[model samples]
Target chain A: MRIAVQAESFDLGAEANAFAAGVAGAGAVVTFTGVVRDLPEGGLQAMEIEHYPGMTQKAITAIAEEATQRWGLCDLLVIHRYGRLAPGEAIMMVATAAAHRAAAFEAAEFLMDYLKSRAPFWKKEITTAGGDWVAAKDADEAALDRW
Target chain B: MMQVLYFAWVRERIGVPREAVETEAATVADLVADLIAREDRYAAAFADLSALRVALDQELAEFDAPLAGVREVAFFPPMTGG
Candidate 1:
């Protein structure tokens, strides 16, 4: 298991390949990447993500540990970036490997659901109108109930 | 004395990221009540407890959690990570 909370951009393909290669007994692998979305109304200049440094790593590690405990995952990787990013830029990624596809897929989804609300990162969008902090959606919170 | 930390809009409103707070509060809620009493900035930032989350010693915690031996406390809005 690897969890990286960083400000530098990551190569999703490279990371995924590396993770898959390093896993010894993984028959299946799954990867998910989150990207900064361009607003439909346009003028999204950038997104600034702020995080609680000490807690961010700890929380993600705990979440990953939970994912491993609940599933038969062979390996897991999580990379979440902070700092400034532009629209269409990758913000974070998660990859899971397991002997079977079901465990790999379910663990990846569980990681995402927990990370969306539990991680200590906040996002602010800078647009032509102004900058505004993204509010945590009720739906996102509700999404946690499934797991 | 305890180290108090704020993040995002909480830091923006409180005008500082962290501070050493001298207090006699017994719990997270007590500390917040004291901060709200300090000035309007804190009062405004803490006006709605439901919108805020607390952490004691870098662990997510409830406002009513005790602070007897906690060395650090943090306040911020709900996380929008992922």
Candidate 2:
């Protein structure tokens, strides 16, 4: 299991390949990447992300650990970025490997759902109109109830 | 003295990232009450506790959680991560 919390951007395809190669005997690998998106009205210059320095890594690691235990995952990787990101730029990614596709897919979705609300990061969208902090969605919170 | 940190709009409202606070408060809510009494910015930021979340020593906690041995406390809106 690997968890990285950094401001630097990453290469999604390369990282996915590396994660797959490293998990030798695993039969399935699933990867999900999150990207910065523009607003419906369209003038998003960037999305500035802020995170609690000490807590971010700890929280993500704990979440990944839980995923591993619950899914019996062979390997997992999570990379999250903190700082300004332009629209279309990759923000973060999660990869999961398991003996079968079901565990790999389920674990990846679980990781994303938990990270959506449980992580310490916050996003502020910078549009031409001005900046606004993204509000926590009720749907995201309710997603946890499924688990 | 305990280190109190703020994030996102809470930091913007309080006008600082973190500070060392001397308090006699027993719980997170008590500390918040003292801060609100001390300054208008704090009051505005903490006006609605329901919209906010607290972390005691980097772990998500409740407003009524004790602050006895906690070295750090953080206040922020609900996380919108992922």
Candidate 3:
């Protein structure tokens, strides 16, 4: 499993292909990319993500390990960005490779779930009123409990 | 010594990213109460524990669990992770 904490956007095709080829037992590679959406409808603006330097990456790596142990995943990659990000930019990516699509998909989802609830990251939304910290979403935490 | 972390609004209210405190907390809940009672800033930051989540050594944990030899504790709002 490969986990990355970076500020730059990534190419999904290259990452997916690499994961697919890396593991001989892998027959499927599933990925989920997160982009900054303008609004409920569609608009373009800016967003900022904050994270603790040493701690953030460590936390994510541990989450990836958990997913690997639980799902027997062959390969996994998690790339999350920090700092100011404009709309349409990729903020995070979770790619999982496994013997089948089910394990790959579950691993990807589990990675995301643990990352969301466990990692130490915060977001600020820029709006007409300037910028403010994003509130924690109950659904996100609840989603983890279900797993 | 236990390392404590504050995230998001909790960080803003507490005015620090992290703190190392010496404690003999019997449970996570007791530690929070001690922190809030330390000062107005802590009180304000931890005023609403309902919206907060506690993690013991980076894993999500319940409040009533014993602190024991825990080296790290973190407080943050419910996750909005994808």
How is the predicted docking of candidate 2 categorized under the CAPRI scheme? high
Residue A134's lDDT in candidate 2: 97
Question: Model 3: which residue pairs collide?
Answer: none
* lDDT (C-alpha) at residue B5 in model 2: 99
Model 2 regions more than 4 Å off: none
lDDT of 3: 0.82
Specify the poorest-scoring 10-residue window by lDDT in model 1 chain A.
Answer: A127-136
Q: Write the per-residue lDDT of candidate 3 for residues A78-133, one digit (tens) a residue.
A: 88888889988888999988889999998888888778767877788777667777
Q: What is the C-alpha lDDT of each candidate?
A: 0.96, 0.96, 0.82
* DockQ of every candidate: 0.94, 0.94, 0.43
Residue by residue across A54-77, what tens digits does model 2's lDDT show? Answer: 999999999999999999999999
Q: Taking the tens digit of each residue's C-alpha lDDT, what string does model 1 give over A7-126?
A: 999999899999999999999999999999988888899999999999999999999999998897899999999999999999999999999999999999999999999999999999
DockQ, candidate no. 3: 0.43
Greater-TM-score candidate between 1 and 3: 1
Task: List, in the given order, the native-contact fraction of each candidate.
Answer: 0.94, 0.90, 0.42
TM-score of 2: 0.99
Which is better, 2 or 3, measured by DockQ? 2
lDDT of 3 by residue, B1-82 (tens): 9999887788889999898998777999999998987899989988888888888887778988789989889888765554
